[model samples]
Every structure is written in structure tokens, then in C-alpha cells.
Target: MAPKQDKKVEEEEDAIYEVEEIVDHRRSKTKHNMVEYLIKWKDYAPEFNTWEKEHNVYSKGLINIYWAKQPYTLTQFKKKTHEGESSIPKKRPASSQATKIDRKQLAQEIKSSQISTSPPTGLVWTDIDAIVNVFHSEPNTYFAEVKWPGGKRNTYIPTRIIKKYNPLKLIYYYESQLEFYLPP
Candidate 1:
């Protein structure tokens, strides 16, 4: 009974905003085949437009209409591959590999020392104070400069490593970059 009442309250609190239009669409970088729609709300200004996950926007009619007007199909969008040089400068492979091996060794040492850094079944516990920047080294490979808590100099860590740990930070950085580059 309490659960039902709680659900009802939750439904009541949820605001249903009318989607004015699907302004744009982009395939998600992290999730294959997943697309995000830029939603413009009826009563909101352009600044309020947001990129919503495929499942988050519920209006089937709007989604279908948006796709219908698109010149390319989702399949075509998925296959539009670009092999141009990365905007971000590349790092030396030798240095990058050395840094990665050191981190792995440190994690192993921590585990052997019984420092309770992480549970036995999980990945090693890494403390990332912040992600300073992201760089693309090659096609489908990115690196992030991460700051540590102990005042150590920032280290270049592969984005794949960071993605498994803190995906939101990467998302935020990319989103911010889009805002600057996207045409008004």
C-alpha cells in the first residue's frame, strides 16, 4: 500500500513538458547504435533545449516525425564514418605505454598490500581528482589528462580507462566542446 502511494506521489510530481520539436540528432559515442535527440520544449526558450537519451523522450509520434524529415536513415547515419585526422594532437606511444604499465603495477602492488583499495572481484580503486583535458591520439582512441589528489603532476590516461571509471566527466567535456563548435 505504501509503495503504491509513493508511486502515485512520484507520478504527480513529475512534470510532463510538451516537446516542441526534435531539433537535431546524434549517435551516442559510448553506446553503439544509441541515438540522442535534441529536444525543444513548447514553453521553453532555445537555451532550454537538451539532448535527451533515446528512451527518455516518450513521444513516438514526434520521434517518427523527426526521423521522417531526416534525409538519411538511422542505418546511413550509423555508417557515416570519418577517417580524417584527429583535431587533438597525438602523444608518443612509448611514453603512453610506460605510464599505463606503471598504473597497472601500482594497482597490483596495492592489492597485494591488502590496503582495501578495492574489493577482490572489482577493478582497482583509482582516485581521480579531476579530468583536466581530453585528447584524441588516433581513430577510436582518446586520452585524458587527469589530476590526482596528492598534488602530483597530471598524467595522461587513456580515455578507455577513464570511461569505465567516470563516464560523466568525459560526457560533460564533449558536450561543452560541442556547444562551442556547433553553429548558431
Candidate 2:
């Protein structure tokens, strides 16, 4: 009679462990430099989601399935805190020395390329004008130096949006976003 009761309790514990679905997942690093998945489980409240070690979750096929369902190829994974702020560290302004060097290098590269110095016009400006700089400010993140329809050059536009415009066939079949050229 005691053995039968213990078996029923074990069955109940097994039911609790079953995962119905995976809501979301983010990769995080532990103090020991080990990678883990911060998994948000379906049917469970957000507070109950757990960060399971990568090795443990990978063997169970949970992480792979989650990645397949929602593919995000970006390098960084942003996690939010309880206060609604992002956990990712803010990007520091590029140092003046580094900025100067980058500017010189970019100038030389652009000069050699066939890309026009004038702002793009009409349909091109609306569809494919490239993002020239990105700022840390809220509400507006990208600054595009566009050519107005009338051939006006260096007209800076503050936009909160930008998207990938070109892909390169270099070493890794790499994809590049619209060029971001910081003004001197």
C-alpha cells in the first residue's frame, strides 16, 4: 500500500516537469564563462522561467527547436530587466583617436569605390538611401545623409529606422547593412 502511494506521487512530479511549449529564449553567460539558455516556458508565468545550462537543454532538443521556430541571426541577445530597461551595456562613444583613424580609413575606401558623393534622389532616396550614422539618443537612432529630390547634398535626416540593403560574398558569405559613414 505504501509503495503504491509513493508511485502516484512520482507520477505527479513527472507531470509537473513536462514542458508544453517554449515561449522565448536568450543566450546568457554564467560567471564561469559557461553559456546558458534563459528559457521562457509556455503556460508558466514569466517569473518562473529558468536559465538552464546549455549542455542540459541542448541534450533535450529544446534549444534547437526554439532556434528553428524563431531565427535571429544577430550576435547580441538583449534581455530586459524588471524595470523595463535592457540588460545590455550601452555603447560608449568612439574615442576621438579611434574616430579619426576610422574616418581616414573610410574616406579612402569610399573614394576608391564608385558610390556617388551626391545624395540619392526621388525613389532611391525613399527606398534605399543609406544610413550614414547611428546615435545613442532615444526616439531617433539613425542619421541618414540624403540627397533631396532637387540634388541638395548633405541633408541630414533623423530616422529611428534602418534595414539591411546589401549582402557581400566575402569569406563567410557575409551580409552587410546599409553603409554607416560617420561625418567628419
Candidate 3:
């Protein structure tokens, strides 16, 4: 029984946890030490402790990370964080900064904004802007955004409408759209 206890202790020793880290290359300059590093964050990575065991290179010096998520050059892994969710997540303001916001109202706003239309009676609008994706250049795959009466939106709309409407004409519209939005 004593021997079994000793073996159990040895097995527990093998289960040691090592924290993983990321050294961001974009924010890093070659140096002996003290590179730009990222602490393991929530929902952005596999369990850092487990990853450390699998990779065998658990040190911050070996791994690279970014303040913002991006494609990893070494492992070709995509590191993604949920900081910028489609709908803003409910965050409790620090108790130190004591202030009250109607949480139910905030949630209601989020629920409406995230959805295309409301549940009771929703007016379905085709994702017109999304369909007209404007790319860098005209290649095999092209893109553009078809402007509706409203602001910059990401929805698909039929191209024929662009030809008929004066404001909706797809001439050098990409260049001019900024004129309306930005000062010369």
C-alpha cells in the first residue's frame, strides 16, 4: 500500500502544469530577451497547460503571440479571441466605478441589432452590399459593395438597380463614396 502511494505521487509529478505564452513578432524586434509577449487569454487558445505538454516548447521565448489575433507564421495556426464578438457581450462595470445600466434594456438592444429583423414582424432585406464585394483589382474573383439609401452595410443586392438609379450608379462610385462621407 505504501508502494502504491509512492507510485501515485510519481504519476502526479508527471502531471505538472506549465503555462504557455506567445511572443508577438509584429510587435517584437530581434533581441536577446524581453520580446513582445501575450499572456494566455480566455477562449483564444487551447488549454495552455496541455498545449505546453504537447508542443514541448512552452516558453514565451519560443512561441509568438499578438495583442490582436492573427495567423501564426511558425505553426500556421490561427489564434482567435472573442473580444470582438458580432454582438457586444454584457460586461459588468467594476464595482469600484459604481454605476447602474439597465441590463435588460442593453440585452434587448443587442438582441435586435444582431438579428437582421425583429421576430414579431421582420422586414427581410437582402444582403445587397455583401453581394457586391469590391476587390483590390478585377481578378477571376471580384468584389464590390452596392450602396443602398442608408449607410455602409454588408448585404447582397441585385446589380441591375445600380444601372437604373442615378445615385446607385456603379461608375467610379467607390472613389466618390468617400467624398460624401469625408471632407475634401
Q: Which of the numbered candidates is closest to the native, going by highest TM-score? A: 1
Ranking by TM-score: 1, 2, 3
Residue 42 local lDDT, model 1: 87
Question: Which digits, one per residue and each the tens of the lDDT, describe model 3 over residues 100-122?
Answer: 23323433443344322211122
The sequence of per-residue lDDT tens digits that candidate 1 reaches over residues 1-184 is: 9999999899757645677899999888789678899999887999999999988875544665565455445565667642243546243343556556544564444334432222123223255666655655456866665666657555666677667777776776666444122232
Q: Candidate 2 on 19-47: residue-level lDDT in tens?
A: 44455444454444344666665567878
Instruction: Give me the displacement of residue 123 in model 1, in angstroms.
Output: 46
CA-lDDT, candidates in order? 0.62, 0.42, 0.35
TM-score of predicted structure 3? 0.20
Candidate 1 clashes between residue pairs 3 or more apart in a chain or in different chains? none
